[model samples]
Target: MKMSDKKEILNSDKAPEPVGLYPHARRVGNLLFLSGVGPRKRGSKEIPGVTLDHLGNIAAYDIEAQCHSVFENVRHVLEASGSSWDKLVDVTVFLTNMQDDFKTYNEVYARYFKDNQPCRTTVEVNALPTPIAIELKCIAVVDG
Candidate 1:
């Protein structure tokens, strides 16, 4: 099949707009690849659980809140792409402060993927495009 015939762009109003030039997710054949998802609210720049100083440095943040928002955003993207949490195959997580936040993030993540846990890799990153505590990039397989 032609490339165009096997791919499609996915978007959801429930998720925030991409920080850069990209769709929320793209489906190639039956696999859906989601862009990095931050905790920013849909249709707004407000990031839950984030508190920044005057200079925009993170003063205090709640990793649990960020995790919930990020997963909710991922859920919206998955639903838009004709998939669901159970269909997720893999997840790549990025954290700004792994030492301080990994435990809380993991606790919240376990609540989301309690039964159908996807293969995951979590890594510490210097920063994210936004000032959020965490971000998630995921892949899922859609039903034919």
Candidate 2:
């Protein structure tokens, strides 16, 4: 395939830097694929609403705060990729404690997604790469 056919990596200065080598998002044709985004903000390691114990373990976390931050992060990525929240087609959410956090997460999710309802699948996971309790993987369409 030609080099032009390869995916274009996208990043957002308004969003948090990824913990790994990957860019915040990638564009393949008219579709924008976003990497997993957590609650951490740009230029900071502190997870929003997360309280750590003396041993650096997660002592407490606010799912609501994480949800809002993660959603805004997704928006930044989408916009940086030449897309928007209404352009999102699908989203996959990862939660470390589904049973305890789902309700609050869903409520916060409703506030942002009420108008632009995208296909979503939420699942419980043992852990994330970081101490964050929630993360979002999203895909959206870019206009030609």
**Once superposed on the true structure, which residue ranges of model 1 sit more than 4 Å away at CA?**
2-5
How do all models score by TM-score? 0.94, 0.95
lDDT for model 1, please: 0.91
Model 2 whole-model lDDT (C-alpha atoms): 0.92
Candidate 2 lDDT at 82 equals 91
**lDDT measured at residue 106 in model 1 versus the true structure, 0 to 100:** 89
Residue 13 lDDT (model 1): 84
Q: How would you encode candidate 1's per-residue C-alpha lDDT over 83-134 as one tens digit per residue?
A: 9999999999999999999999988888889998899999999988888879
- Angstrom error of the Cα, residue 94, model 1: value is 0.4
Cα lDDT tens digits, model 2, 55-127, are 9899999999999989988988888889999999999999999999999999999989999999999999999
Clashes of each: 0, 0
